[model samples]
Target chain A: MRIAFTSVGTNWDAQIDPRFGRTAFLVLFNEETAQLEAVDNSGVQADAHGAGTAMAQRIYELHPDVLITGNGPGDTASKALKNLHMRIYVEAHNMSLKEAYEKYKKQELTAL
Target chain B: MTNSGIFKLAIASGKGGTGKTLLSTNLADYLARKQAVLLADLDVEEPNDALFFHAENKVITPQYKMIPDWQSDRCTLCGDCTRQCKFHAVIRLGEFITVFNELCHSCYACSDLCPEQALPMKPYRMGETRHQILNGLQLIESRLDVGQEQAVPLIHATQKYICELESKPAIQILDCPPGTSCPVVAAVDGADLVLLVTEPTPFGLNDLKLAVETMRQIDKAFAVVINRQGMGDDAVENWCKSENITVAARIPYDRQLAEQYAAAKLAWCDNTALEEALEELALFIQQKQVQYA
Candidate 1:
């Protein structure tokens, strides 16, 4: 299974692309191969819609089975993610990027 | 004295990158020297005043409800709300009526048009209004919940805090949120004067005209302040001259002032000339209030 997380920075690594204003982040994870990769999506697009497109493209790129965030359950951006066959997990509060995978392991995250 | 209480002055612009915050804070700081000033930051979505002032903060909780609190038993599934909604915020399929709360404009048309009266509007908590004391000035601010789309409710709540001020000053400077939307209207509704901040760029000129038209439609008193004055073309001044709106103040481009601002220092501290200009603006607003009186 593959997963992704949206955070303030690009990922836990804190790397960001400087082209477009670096304001948001996207991280990808894999369960089968235990591979994790995180990339900055701020440079990929502009505005909220652009952020949605960037997430969709990441799903396409990683073919993630799950995606997670602190919020954004029914927002337009999250709806776009649903279009890509990616399940969404709206966490209750702030959890670290590493802890998200642990929550997934404990089945605390919702599939949708 | 005919209620010469320095009326709340809302400084707004229709677009981003305008000097709305810069001008508002400076004006408030300047007015504080003579009178007690309350600077309301109604732009809850992106409250940057604290970013500029970095002081202790207080929060004011905002509460607002949305329309169409659906009763599943009474709902006929006629899809009336989905049909009437201009924003496509509602959808009725089969036995369920789904609502995307963020997209809702709270127009109440959906609930009013429902036949069975199944849809009842419910009061929902939206965001919070906050106050921060920065450098001896009362900074009234509002922060909309990260995902909440109801900015108007918080903006209105911000006004309530402004009304609670112990002593009204000769001037109340309001740093309004960007854009000429519902939130902007709520911010500028009761202001006696509006100082529109703008620049000479094409984008600034374009949005300034939109803001001016909004003010005209609402029949409010207003003037323009050209910021970063010398960098952009002269079209901003020309547009003001053609529209017969007063160009109240012009702030020249000074990299040193910009650097000082970034370093969290006062912009007018080193520039005595700029300080004198802002004082003249205070005097100008005083005269305008008397003229209207």
Candidate 2:
């Protein structure tokens, strides 16, 4: 299972960003590989329109099984992610990627 | 003045409520006495120019903009359409593609460039236009649907309708939307001259600079109008003078004018000062039009 976390930095200890669409970085953790890979989302942050949709497209292309963020995806982004049947977990704000991953493992986070 | 082309005068504002509609509708009515005038309310989002008019024979037409109609059956799952859409309106989701109509710019890049020919462009209702003739003036009001995100497409459609009208009036007045955005560009595009209405406040001056920059960038001939002359400082007039832009006319701040405007009455109808101001503006535009034509 691959878990995507909206993060401020590229590392596992990076604090999970509250914003899903405008997050600066996305940290992906693959259970099979036990590896953390970061995707830069800063470009979408400055998009004049549909920044969330662009980030959602990127997330969908990444094929993450689950997403963790402070808030849920917006309307357009929600529609894009619904196609992948990927569930999004929210209320991960103010936590590190590792803490969010641990909470996800224990089923403590809320599903968006 | 000899040219057969209509003199298009667009009344726009750097800031909202800087008297764009107050100026345009009155100007159109003022000009309509002598010759037929076309008044286009290009403020698609919140059009209120028709409110003050006693319109007759109002005709409403639905407006549409093209968006990608995805045919999933031709399924090769090729991501060409997804990759080409700059707006991110289209995204591939395994067996299906999601197209957000709100985000679509209707640029036709995604549909035409699709290799599988699955994404075909189709008309999607975005807004409506109302055409009414009253007091020898033809009023065309374009209004965007509540949820519609883009205003430029509807403005273009309204302009197209205006172009196809039977009568080629010698004078056309456009009441444009606020700000110097793409919609504003679409509203004022191809206009012979533009009257940028701005007040004397610092916010008005700041946005006036932006509007002036946009006008200069687009190379459109424009003049400044000072609305509510005494309400704020004379910064706008000073800035226009420094930039060598013509201050066409100044409509003084008056309680009566505001009362008439708020009551949905033509402010120029009862106020002699406003009437003179609008007439002065009309004459100024006629001279400017002559210089341009």
Candidate 3:
């Protein structure tokens, strides 16, 4: 299962970005393969109205089973994710990407 | 010298509710007595210029723009149109490409660059133009449909309709939208002169500076008109004095004018002081036409 975390930077040590849509980087961690990858989310800045929805579309394209971020997705994005049967957890803000992922693995983080 | 050319004057205010429509309606009404006048309300979002006059024989024309419409039967999820769209309007989701009409700018870049020729351009109605003829004045008001974000295209369509007129009016007063956005620029562009309507407050002064900067960058001649003069401080007056920008006219804060305006009545024409001010404004515009000509 791939878990996506909204991150401020491309690395694992980077803090989790509070904004889901305008997050700088989306760090994807595969629990099965123990593999980690970071995808740049710079294009979301160009979206004026539906940034959250567009970012959700990008996340859907990545095939992430779960999304972890500081803030919940917007109304439109949340609806899209619901249709895709993706679970979202909102917590672990200001924490590093690696710490957030480890806490999620240990079932320590709150599911929102 | 008799000025035979059409004088296009655009009334714009950087801040909303600064009496742009009030000034434009009265100015057009006063100017129509001597020569033919066309009052084009380019504030497509919420146009209220028609309220001042008893507009008769109204004609509504729909404004459309060609937007990319997809054909699902092409049988290929190649993602060519998605790659070509710069606005992110096209989204590819599990062998299906969805087009968001609101996000599309009607640039046709994706349709033109489509590899399989699946995307076709279709006419999307943006807004409607209402043409009305008053006693001696012609009012062309553009109304953008609700939930529509694109206003510049509708403004352009209204201008095109005006240009196609067989007998072009001697004076065209465009009531522009507030702020120095794309819609304001579209309405004020190619005008003979821009009359910036502003109040005497801090917000009005700050927005006026922005409007002035936009006008200067576009290389258009502009003059300031201070409305509700006594309600606020003299910041606008002092700024205009220091900048050497011409103060074309001033309308004082009158309770009667406000009440009449709320009732959709032309009370300015009845008041001696307001009528004289509007006439002087028309005279000033005539002098400017001769000077620019």
Candidate 4:
């Protein structure tokens, strides 16, 4: 399963960004292959409106099964993700991306 | 065709409550005696020019814009519309595609590029323009819907309405909205002349600088009209002098004018000085019209 984590930087050591839509980077962790990748989120940051929805679309395009972030997605994005059958989890505030992914693996984060 | 044979003067200000409406209404009132005048309150968000006039007859016309309406029966969620929309107004979630009208800029990129032809353009009422006849002056103002985000369409509609008038007025005074945003640009652009009304305070000066930059960028001919002259320092005047922009008129700070304005009364009714200043402004515009012509 592909899990996405909103991060402050491109690396696994980078802190988890609290904002889902305006985060600097979205780090994708492939559980089956044990490979991690980062996608820059500057395009979503520059959006005038519906940043959450735009971010959700970007994530949906990646075919992520789960989204792990410090904060929950906005109303519009939540509706879109729910329709896409994607589960979202909120945790890892002030923690690194790796730490957040470990907590997600342990089922310690709150589902939103 | 460029001239339109009618003098178009736009009153603009970067900051709100800098006496733009006051100057516009008074100038319209003064100019009506010499020529047929049309006062177009382009500040659709908060139109207040109509408040100053005792309108005898009023006609309201609804303004509409084309927005994308999706058709689910078309049997395809190709995501063509979703990918084409730069505004993020359209979103495809699994089997469903949702359209957010509020974020839509009406660019029609989605509907135009839709391969499935599921998206169709529909007219959405954004605002209403009121054509009012007051004593001798004609008032054309637009009122935006409470939650509507699109204002430029209404403003353009008002301008088109004026052009289609049976008898075009000699002078069309556009009372523009505050700030140097898209709405303000729509109001002031293509005008024969733009009068930037500003106060003489720090906030006023800062915003005036921005307004001036906007006007210059658009290559529009503009002049400054300073309100409450004595309230602030000589910085504004000095800056204008340095910039080589003319200070066309200066309305002094007066308690009676403020009181009358608060009561929704014309300040020039009891004040001859203000009335004379407005008259001079009218003459100045006339001279500019001739000079530009």
In model 3 chain B, which range of ten residues has the least summed lDDT? Answer: B1-10
Query: What's the fnat for candidate 2, on a 0 to 1 scale?
Result: 0.54
* TM-score (C-alpha) between model 4 and the true structure: 0.89
Stretches of candidate 1 off by over 4 Å are A1-112, B1-6, B54-57, B112-117, B133-136, B164-170
lDDT of 1 by residue, B78-117 (tens): 8777667665556553356666677667779888998988
True-vs-predicted CA distance for residue B212, candidate 4, Å: 0.9
* DockQ-based ranking: 2, 4, 3, 1
Best by lDDT: 2
lDDT of 1 at B126: 70
Cα lDDT tens digits, model 3, A3-112, are: 99899987789999989889898999888898889999897777665677578678779979888899878765665566677777787897898888888889888786
Alpha-carbon local distance difference test for all models? 0.71, 0.87, 0.85, 0.86
Assess the local accuracy of residue B138 in candidate 1 as a C-alpha lDDT between 0 and 100: 82
Tens-place lDDT per residue, model 4, B216-240, is 9999999999998899898899999
Give the candidate order by descending lDDT. 2, 4, 3, 1
Tens-place lDDT per residue, model 4, A21-77, is 888898998889989999988877556777877887787789899888887887767
Binned by DockQ into CAPRI classes (incorrect, acceptable, medium, high), candidate 1 is incorrect
Q: Candidate 1 clashing pairs?
A: B6-B170, B60-B129, B65-B124, B69-B120
Question: What is candidate 2's CAPRI-style docking category based on DockQ?
Answer: medium
Candidate 3 wrong stretches, greater than 4 Å:
A10-14, A43-54, A70-83, A89-112, B1-4
| Interface root mean square deviation per prediction | 9.3, 1.5, 2.5, 1.7
